[model samples]
Target: MSLILKDLTVSAGKRPLLEIPELVLPAAGFVGIIGPNGAGKSTLLKALAGVVSHGGTKTLDGAWPDAGRIAFLPQDFTVSAAMSVADCVLLGRREHLGWRVTGHDRAEVRRVLSMLDLTPLSDARMDRLSGGQQQRVLLAQRLLRDPRLLILDEPTSALDLHHQLEVLSLLKTLSGGMLVIAALHDLTLAGRFAEQLVLIEGGRVHATDSPERILTGGTLDPVYAIRCEVFRDRDSNPVVVAHPAQGARAGSLER
Candidate 1:
């Protein structure tokens, strides 16, 4: 489903954390939000998911089929110590059940657990899982809803390189008819997986375009405060190589 953010602003206590004049998220495929720390990337996602209060309109297209609607996975995921993995994932079906979970809901929970490679951990307590495994389990919970719009905040933070690729690949495969928006810190992985990229800085949208178009040195250098070299791979897609900021040149010796 398409998401339109018009004049969105978010405040935390006395400070404004996010301010977006306008943004249009595509109806399908993966979109990456990239920026430095405290750039309001996570805040943007939370605002769009209606988990936080913000000023502005976030509209999902009416023409688009709203099957399961929206699901959000935050960066810091926490579950009660007593809840099992299966039970946590089963919570995603709560909206459909209205009051109580049924046999059908349990079946869906099983399906999502298997789909996310969590079948083996179904009976395990969520507090006992590793960080990466916990992340996947939470994703499984979100997937149980079969949402049309999936918003994830820093989904790869706790994953190793191998698991990171695996999660991102799974996300790509799952984006066939859904919109997947993630706040990602790894620029290279973001470029590889995301069809489009949105760069934010100082609570403002600096640029939004295809990864090949927005990950360029000209756009990233100032925003990130680092020198970056942009090059093309064998496929002619953009690859960014970052370096430290340039230092002042040494004084020249007298002739």
Candidate 2:
């Protein structure tokens, strides 16, 4: 069982924003979308999540997916004030919720809140919470659903370093059960957590390979215009260190 895409394409007016003739994503794994800014990483995720209009034949397990069964959290997604944290997360279960709230609904909300360390502030208002806390609440909302596909854009963008590491670790663990796709800017971190990496360039997939293969200087230099080196850590994860690419200009990567 895998997510299959065929003839997928997105256009902004007449200029094409993204195009993927064919792609197959593993059913359960962490796949990181890695590329420079404006490389169409977000566009690709939005298309799969149905947040944007695009032309494509996207199927899960050879069949069309149920919209309600997919959980999506955009990078800049925000919520207004005047709502309790618990209530905000509970909204995620709306597809399965009845006219009356069920014990199961409350139980599920409690579970995700605990998973994201939000139970202590579950009663507080969403507007009163800190940015990191608010991000966690939104993530908890998405996790409350028993989704088959989980799509996120910069899932750790709002969190501090410690919390970012914690959430990435959790997402990696969860990917063992369901598909998890995220757009990551930190090459080292992406290499460490992602089982596979989709390297996007100029609105198309330049490469779909393991982080070890995609994080090398030879692979990234042309795309990012930087000179970088890749090494292994104690845990055998790829670690990337990059600098500005060399040219006739004043700024260049140092030796």
Q: Which candidate is the best by TM-score?
A: 2
Candidate 1: regions farther than 4 A off? 63-68, 98-101, 231-237, 248-255
lDDT of each: 0.84, 0.88
RMSD in Å for model 1: 5.0
Each model's total of backbone clashes: 0, 0
For candidate 2, lDDT tens digit of each residue in 27-73? Answer: 88999999999999999999999999999799987786688889999
lDDT score of residue 92 within candidate 1 = 78
**TM-score to true structure, per model:** 0.88, 0.94
RMSD (CA, Å), each prediction: 5.0, 2.6
Error of model 1, residue 73, in angstroms: 0.7
